[model samples]
Target: MALTSHLETLKKKHRDMSEAIDVAQRAPGIDGLRLADMKKQKLRLKEEINRLSN
Candidate 1:
């Protein structure tokens, strides 16, 4: 049960990070490195969620 709740939270964070990445991409002069970092973080969270669920 706890794992399920934590997984939900992680999914939310990943979604939020994805939205942020999209918004950043639309802005002028956005930093590519920072966006890449966010994507990495999101991927980490996704991996963790998968690990826990399985």
Candidate 2:
């Protein structure tokens, strides 16, 4: 049950990060490094979710 809850939270965070990246891309003068970092974090979350799922 706890693992399921953790997975849900990670999924929510991944979704939010994707939205944030989209908004940041639209905004002016977004930091390139920060955006890259956010994408990396999102990828890590996805990997973890996949690992836990199996």
Candidate 3:
């Protein structure tokens, strides 16, 4: 049960990060480093979610 809840939280965070990245891309003068970091974090979350799913 705890694992399921944790997975859900991670999924939600991943979705939120994706949306943030999209918005940041549309904005002017966004920092490349920050965007890359966000993408990396999102990827990590996705990997964790996959691991837990299995």
Best by TM-score: 3
Candidate 3 deviant stretches above 4 angstroms: none
Q: Write the per-residue lDDT of candidate 2 for residues 1-54, one digit (tens) a residue.
A: 999999999999999999999999998999999999999999999999999999
Q: Clashing residue pairs, candidate 2?
A: none
Tens digits of per-residue lDDT for model 1, 1-54: 887889899999989999999999999999989989988998999999889889
Predicted structure with the largest lDDT when compared to the true one: 3
Ten-residue stretch with the least lDDT total in model 1: 1-10
Ranking according to lDDT, highest score first: 3, 2, 1
Q: Note the clash tally of each candidate.
A: 0, 0, 0
As for TM-score, the candidate ahead, 1 or 2, is 2
Better of 1 and 3 by TM-score: 3
Q: Which ranking of candidates, highest TM-score first?
A: 3, 2, 1
Error of 1 at 39 (Å): 0.7
Task: Report, for every candidate in turn, its global Cα lDDT versus the true structure.
Answer: 0.91, 0.96, 0.98
